[model samples]
Target: GAGVSQSPSNKVTEKGKDVELRCDPISGHTALYWYRQSLGQGLEFLIYFQGNSAPDKSGLPSDRFSAERTGGSVSTLTIQRTQQEDSAVYLCASSLAMVTDTQYFGPGTRLTVL
Candidate 1:
């Protein structure tokens, strides 16, 4: 892809339902990341994957959140039993190498729980 593409730009669901957000990163990118942004909060790092290294999953808030990258390309984020507090925009970013340059972000998937 030319840029990071996030699916379901907007989603509305009842609390406790599982939701999966997809991200298609730019071609030839070696670093991929997931982030969260609440109503008024700054971007929060969720996870990062670079090359074949161990993924950095330190930012996931709870056990209900999980993500994975396949073939070092596309990635998916799955939230299980979503909560009201989980309502926010899920952003995915990619770079030729996050360790060296800046990241390019996607439009983001907006998830709303009621």
Candidate 2:
């Protein structure tokens, strides 16, 4: 019955530090996505996980970013060597099945790399 949720809603870290943002998707959802909303920018797709298949990571900006979905329910986005340019709101969404399906979003984790 719970909706998608992200932890440490606001994170402020120094440049070059590593940060891990967590997301818990709603139960029974088969598709999960990670998006980044930068200042004055649109939501940028980061990664997607559907069922047991390998994750789609083409949208990731660089090798500094990575993510994983455990048991098809929870996910974590890790940013290594955080940079000022990486500051943004990391949003997580889950859909019933396909990529075309409607997705429910979390409040997002606002990451500020100082």
Candidate 3:
């Protein structure tokens, strides 16, 4: 099947606005993850969903950041009241299962909050 895909590869928004990023994981994949990467920084884990289990959201930077996976396939990451510091590339990855599997990443959505 195809690899993960994300919509709106690039987004530029004013500070205080909100943005929603979408991801489509590979068919049959049961694990999904969202990460953020700022310039010169490593990828920061944001949220994760595995099968029917509760999502692990401890990595979310703030309450304004949230994500959900519907039908165990597609995922959306929403950032509320965006700030300049929120500027970064949002990456999505998925694997067949949660343990010891290679995660394939999407191209990433580059967000620039002005």
Candidate 4:
């Protein structure tokens, strides 16, 4: 079975640019999450999507951050205007629909804005 995956394991972009990070969750998993971890900082929840319910955007840092899940599977996170403060490791994880269930994470897309 294919595990979760993310693209551009590392990305370097200039401030104010837009970057699209991709995530592929594990097969059959219906719950997906997007999180950001600043350098030497803890994980910060960004968004969460489950099958059919409205997506939870409360955790999103700002209006520039947005994500969407398609067909209850793959998801993409778009940072409309990348900022220096946005430089961090963007991690995506998937779980088996149990809040207490441990989530499986991807290698992560490290974004570095200059």
Best of the candidates, TM-score: 3
Q: Each prediction's Cα lDDT score?
A: 0.94, 0.95, 0.96, 0.92
Best by lDDT: 3
lDDT head-to-head 1 vs 3, winner: 3
Candidate 3 TM-score to native:
0.98
Give the Å shift of residue 9 in candidate 4. Answer: 0.8
Ranking by TM-score: 3, 2, 1, 4
Model 2 per-residue lDDT tens digits across residues 1-86: 58999997999999999999999988999899999999999999999999999999999999999999988889999999999999
Clashing pairs in 2: none
Count of residue pairs whose backbone atoms collide, per candidate: 0, 0, 0, 0
Q: Which parts of model 3 are misplaced by more than 4 Å?
A: none
Better of 1 and 2 by lDDT: 2
Kindly list the per-residue Cα lDDT of model 4 for residues 1-114, writing each as its tens digit.
478999979999999999999999989888999999998999999999987789999999899999988888889999988889999999999998849878999999999999
- Sort order, lDDT high to low: 3, 2, 1, 4
Q: Flag clash pairs in model 4.
A: none
Question: For residues 1-114, what per-residue lDDT tens digits would candidate 3 score against the true structure?
Answer: 478999899999999999999999999999999999999999999999999999999999999999999999999999999999999999999999987999999999999999
